[model samples]
Target chain A: MAVEDKLKIELGKQGVFVTTVNEIYNWGRKNSVWPLQFGLACCAIEMIATTMARYDLARFGAEVFRPSPRQADLMIISGTITKKMAPQVVRLYNQMAEPRYVIAMGACAISGGPFKQGYNVLKGIDRYIPVDVHIPGCPPRPEALIHAFMTLQAKIDAQPLTGTERPRHLDAAAMSEFPVPTQGAHDLEPPANRLVWPLPAPVASGENCG
Target chain B: MASSPYFSLAILFLAALGFGLAPLGLAVAWAKLVSPAKPNAIKNAIYECGLESKGDAWVQFRSAYYLYAIIFLIFDVEAVFLVPFAVAFTGLGISACVAMLVFVLLLAEGLAWAWAKGVLTWA
Candidate 1:
């Protein structure tokens, strides 16, 4: 629960501030999410527009698009993920520091979009790396990207500092490295990280379930 | 001692030091107490651009470029100082003229060293 829940507005109206360590930590983290600078295809144009003055992503405190994954806190997979580019994308996500977030920002990034039929495209980025938010659009408007940012902020805000459900960074047992898929003779070997994307359960022998 | 001017200055100095260092200390404490470090082979890799680094970062450059740089500096300084000296020749005293001459001579010595070493010749 937020510190505001305990103190309520009366104390805030009197000019006294109240907060917990978790509240401060979450507040600081949610505000300054620097996204990794990268784009794959058409959706990248809309992503760029979000950073520009028109949409002004700075109002939400995520104006900076860091060129290096190491410095980035969020990765907006803003375009189509081709089979060839999937490995490199996963590698960049792995390189990012803990408390990192990913927003699958476009139909293409969430799923292969129009390219789903194409042999060269990967179905979805979440199949490889765990995606925090999935935004659906052929190329979503700047407003949509901003909405995604707010959603990510909400997700960050809800995470408990010390608990079983606390974020991946706080949990020592949480896997730091999601195995980067390598090239094979036919396709990317071991297609997806099963930990993130679970395989479908087989049907019972006598079951007539559709 | 409290009434002394330096006492205030000492307090301000300590305040300034704390101002600079307090955030750094808090960040270190936060990392230790809150954030559990998660480092792996890919995360610890040298290059951050997603591409695997090719070849060694340490590579040797030819020393011939050093001689060229030294020769360039000698002439560049000579020209710069000589032009100013010529422009101010009427206002300059005899001692000033001697000082300018000495500066030029020092640069000339560097030129002579480069000439003797055959650094001027392009290999």
Candidate 2:
């Protein structure tokens, strides 16, 4: 049980602060969510705007955009992921230190935006890596990006430090690496990762591509 | 030992050592008790730019570059010494002026030698 459940708010008025270790841990984690400085397409422009003085992403404690995946806590997929770029993206995601989160920030990143019908564009990044939050927009505005950031922070705050539902980094049994797809003669080999993106059941007609 | 002059210094030394090590110890303990290690080949790879690294980092450079280094030092040292000499020129004595002249002459001699040896030529 949370320490807040047992402590009365009246005690807080007396200047005593009561919190569990988990709460403190989550507080620190949520506040210092440094995003990876990776951008793909037009949505990246909005992501940049979110960090500038006008939108002021620093107030939310996430203005530090890490150039390396090793130091980053969040990956904002802010554009279209072409077939050629998907492998490198997944590889970079795998290299990030655990307790990492991904925010698919636009229609392109979430579902390839208007490029969904394009042969070269990947339908969604979630087909390869697990996405923590999905912000839907052709190219989401800076405000929408901030909303997704808060949603990710709330998600991080809710994560239990210990339990079956604990995050992948804390759990020994969780997958450490998602397979990177390579380009083939016609298309990307094994188009999507079955582990993260399960194929739908076959239709009554015998036409299906796995 | 407590009454010794160095007793406070010894305490400070140990405190400094503890200050540096305590956080490291706490981090190790946190890793052991809270977060599990998950190492993989890609994560351990040398390059962090999302692409596989190709070719060895070690490559040979031409020994001919040493001539350029010597020639560069001539102008480099002259510029460094000339700035201070110019700033302090008005107040300097004859001896100081002579000393500065000698320094400039030495650098000029080196530059002359490099020019004679054709070191300034790009070829």
Candidate 3:
């Protein structure tokens, strides 16, 4: 007999059931994580492939790719975060309802991948929004995404429901919004600081615009 | 109470309200009690795909598209009206046939007018 069934049979005589509301709640949330359909760059194509019949993401209950941030439970940062696109990403992250999770889906999203050297690419999405999981690859295979989902599920399963300090999403007091980046004359600047290293002050204009 | 003519309707209304509100109320309560309401300035900011929004959201659009949509709606609704007529064609009187013919002809006239005006052209 299954352990749960055996336990249930024994507990039935005593009129008792074992399990906490938190565990049940976490299980439900982890299983039915609806990811926002937003995708950034090349990694987005791989992200789409994960949802195809061969590698159906539906098996893990995260197949629903919601178009609206209000409806999504997760945001998979699927590509490089350009300085121009950072604010919008943060905003979308902010717009998602509480209990929202983020999975940095590729090396680009994790640390700008090959584009890290590019002036316009943000080093990582984590600088702007809290990332729950990071899957590293130029464009991670669909299997990597599935593995990341498993890791995220493990993280969710470990969260305490009744602690003084709850999970970030569960602890209203701990949750803080990220500042939206603004466009500067030369590049995008985060509200608090320069998102990227500032280029040396315009070399006296007479120099070549190299 | 059960014999009253309005009893069933009253029960149905209450049932409908319960059905709609129960889940909504439960969800709201769960979110409030179980989910934390940590609001920070950054989390609340409007999202424009990560980049800061520029200028007003409003933009100008051609009014011609509205005309096209209105025309489409008129024709779409006309098709709905035709379904019953088509289904009852044998039972419908000659008068009904004449009325439907006039109705179709009137719509055709509108289509021809729109065509002549070049409203149907992509350009």
TM-score of chain A of each: 0.91, 0.92, 0.81
Candidate number of the best DockQ: 1
lDDT of all predictions, in order shown? Answer: 0.86, 0.87, 0.79
Task: For candidate 2, write residues A173-197 as lDDT tens digits.
Answer: 8899888888876566667777887
Candidate 1 lDDT, A81-123, residue by residue in tens: 9888998999999999889999998998987898886667878
Highest lDDT among the candidates is held by which one?
2
- Weakest ten-residue segment in model 2 chain B by summed lDDT: B31-40
Q: Interface Cα RMSD for all candidates? A: 0.9, 1.0, 2.9
**Candidate 2 docking classification:** medium
Q: Write the per-residue lDDT of candidate 3 for residues A56-89, one digit (tens) a residue.
A: 9999999999997777879999998887788788
Worst 10-residue lDDT window for candidate 1 chain B reads B114-123
What is the TM-score of each candidate's chain B when compared with the real chain B? Answer: 0.74, 0.69, 0.56
What is the alpha-carbon lDDT of model 2 when measured against the actual structure?
Answer: 0.87
